[model samples]
Target: MPFDQPLPREVKVTDSASLFRLEERACDLSLNSRLDPAWVRANAALDGAHYLWPALWNSLAHRPEVPRQLRCELLITLRAGDRVVSWLDVLPADFNPLPRVTSREEGMQVSQLLDRAPSVREWLLREGGGSGQQ
Candidate 1:
C-alpha cells in the first residue's frame, strides 16, 4: 500500500513498543512496505544468497530517503512467522537497557544506548535474528 494510503485506524503512541501496534495511529509511513512479513519469511530462505540484499536496502533507505532499511528489516522480522503462543514484542528502536523509558521529556537513556553500537547490534541480532530475511 502507498504510504499515503490510510489504514483502518491508528495506534496510539503511549509507548515506543506501540510502533508495531499497526493500529490506525501506530504506524509510520514506509516506502518499502512491499517487503511485508509474508514476503520476508518466504524469502528468508534466500537470505545470504541474495548478493545485494543489504546494499539494495541501504540504497532504498539511505540514498532514496525511504524509511531506515535496518529498521524496516527489524520490523518485518518481528512480524514474520510468529506462530508461537507468546506475543512478538516489537521493541521501538528507541528503547533499550533494563528499566529504561523513552519520552520527549526527562528521558535521556537514548543517548547512552546510541553510543553503545555493539549493544544495539547485538540486540538487533538477538531480536531480529542473525539471518532473518523472510
Candidate 2:
C-alpha cells in the first residue's frame, strides 16, 4: 500500500504471535518527570515502532476487514509543574494512523507510565500526521 494514500480495507499481517514478539522487543515510550521529545522521536524511528500498524492488524487479519481500534494513554510531565495525561485511540482504517490525543489531563502527580499502550500507535504516527506530543 502507498504511504500517501488511505489505508486499504485489508492488510497482510504475519500473525498475532509476531506482534507479541515485536512488542516484547519494543522500547518503552513513557515519560516520567521530564518530557523528553527526543526520546519520543528516537523510539518512533525504531524498527519495532515503525511496524506497529502491521502488529496492530496482525490479530484482525483473519476476521472480516473492519476498523481496528485500541484506546491508549500517554503520560507527559508538563514544564509547568504538572503532568499532562493524554488518551488516544488508534484507528488504522484512517489515512492518518497516528493515535491522536482525544482527552487530556493536567496536574496529576503520577509516575511509571504505561509505555507500550501508545507506543504502537503514537510512535508510528507522531512525526507524520499528528500535532501534539505525549
Candidate 3:
C-alpha cells in the first residue's frame, strides 16, 4: 500500500487467539519504545473487533528503518465485546504497537495529543470530515 492510500475502516477478528498473537507481537515490538506494552495490556482488554485508521505514517516516511508495509498501514483499535478497549500503532519491523490511549476519556486525550503534531492533526481533520457525525 502506498502512503497516499487509506486503510479499511474496520477489521473483524473472530478468533480471540489470533488477536492475542497480534497483540503479543505488537507488545514485544513495543518494548524499549515509547509505548509501554505491559501498561497497555493491563489497562485494555484487547479481544474483539479491530478498528483501523491511518496514523502518523507520513512522519515516519523519511526513516529507512521503518518497513514499507508498516509505513502505509493503519493503526489498530481493540474492542472487547462492545466496549472500546485500546488503540495501538502496530510497527512490526521497528517497535510494535505504540499504545496510544484507552477508554472514551483517553480517546479525547489522544485527540488532543495528536493535535500537537501538525501533520497528524491535519490528516485527522481531513479524514474525519465525512465520518457521518454531524
For each candidate in turn, the TM-score is: 0.24, 0.22, 0.35
Model 1 scores what on Cα lDDT? 0.26
The ten-residue window of minimal lDDT in model 3 covers: 71-80
User: lDDT tens digits, residues 7-75, model 3?
Assistant: 432232323343445456655544211223343344234553333333444334455664443322222
Candidate 1 per-residue C-alpha lDDT over 1-134 given as tens digits, one digit per residue, 9 for 90 to 100: 23443222211112223322321111243333232333234433222211001112222435454333322212222233221111122223322221323353423332332333233235446567443211
Highest lDDT model number: 3
Clashing pairs for model 1 are 9-24, 10-24, 10-25, 11-23, 11-24, 11-25, 11-26, 40-134, 41-134, 44-134
User: Which residue pairs does candidate 2 place in steric collision?
Assistant: none
Ranking of predictions according to TM-score: 3, 1, 2
Judging by TM-score against the true structure, name the best candidate.
3
Residue ranges of candidate 1 with Cα displaced over 4 Å? 1-17, 22-105, 117-121, 124-128, 132-134
Stretches of candidate 3 off by over 4 Å are 31-63, 68-82, 91-134
Error of 3 at 127 (Å): 34
Question: What does the lDDT read for residue 34 in candidate 3?
Answer: 26
- Deviation from native of the Cα of residue 127 in model 2, angstroms: 30
What are the candidates' C-alpha RMSDs?
13.7, 14.9, 12.7
